[model samples]
Target: EPEVTQTPSHQVTQMGQEVILRCVPISNHLYFYWYRQILGQKVEFLVSFYNNEISEKSEIFDDQFSVERPDGSNFTLKIRSTKLEDSAMYFCANRLRLATDTQYFGPGTRLTVL
Candidate 1:
């Protein structure tokens, strides 16, 4: 089966710096979402995108964070200013609008903010 892929499997960045994480899709999907899991914490929803715009976003997705689909293929999440709490494994998930409503996730990009 096809899947989503994230780049820079591991990333280390200093606090107050900017970082851009990318997600690429290898198969067809209707809805895309971004999620993060802090150290030892539950997977949290960050944002969801559809029709090339943000459909919904959680409180954690503040001004410091932004999402976009540049080049009409890959999705990207930009953190304008990183903080220590920003460190987590960022995952890219998508849904095929099937009957079961299952979500497929990427391997994830680990972001470590100092």
Candidate 2:
């Protein structure tokens, strides 16, 4: 089955450096989203992208955070000046364009900021 792909399944970064997380959503899906799960916590929506632009984003996705779909394939999320609190499992998901479609989640990428 076709599924979203996330690279660097685990990333370790310094507190003040920038980190870019990458994903390739299911090709047939029309909407892409990013979500974060703090260890043992509920998953929180980060941002949603469609038509090559941001459709929605949470308060947590501030100026320091950005998303892009470079080359019309891979979707990327960049976090500038990582903070300890930013360490979490980030998941990439996609949903079909159909009105009642369900979102399929990709294997999460674990981010650890030291």
TM-score of each: 0.94, 0.96
Highest TM-score against the true fold, candidate:
2
| Top lDDT hit | 2
Once fitted onto the true fold, the runs of candidate 2 whose alpha carbons sit more than 4 angstroms away are none
Q: Report lDDT (Cα) of residue 83, candidate 1.
A: 98
Global CA lDDT of candidate 2, please?
Answer: 0.93
Report model 2's TM-score to 2 decimal places. 0.96
lDDT of 1: 0.91
Q: Which stretches of candidate 1 lie over 4 Å from their true place?
A: 98-100
lDDT of 2 by residue, 1-112 (tens): 8888898899999999999999988886778899999999999999999999999999999999999988788888999899999999999898989868999998989999
Question: CA shift at 106, candidate 1, in angstroms?
Answer: 0.6
Worst lDDT 10-window in candidate 1: 94-103
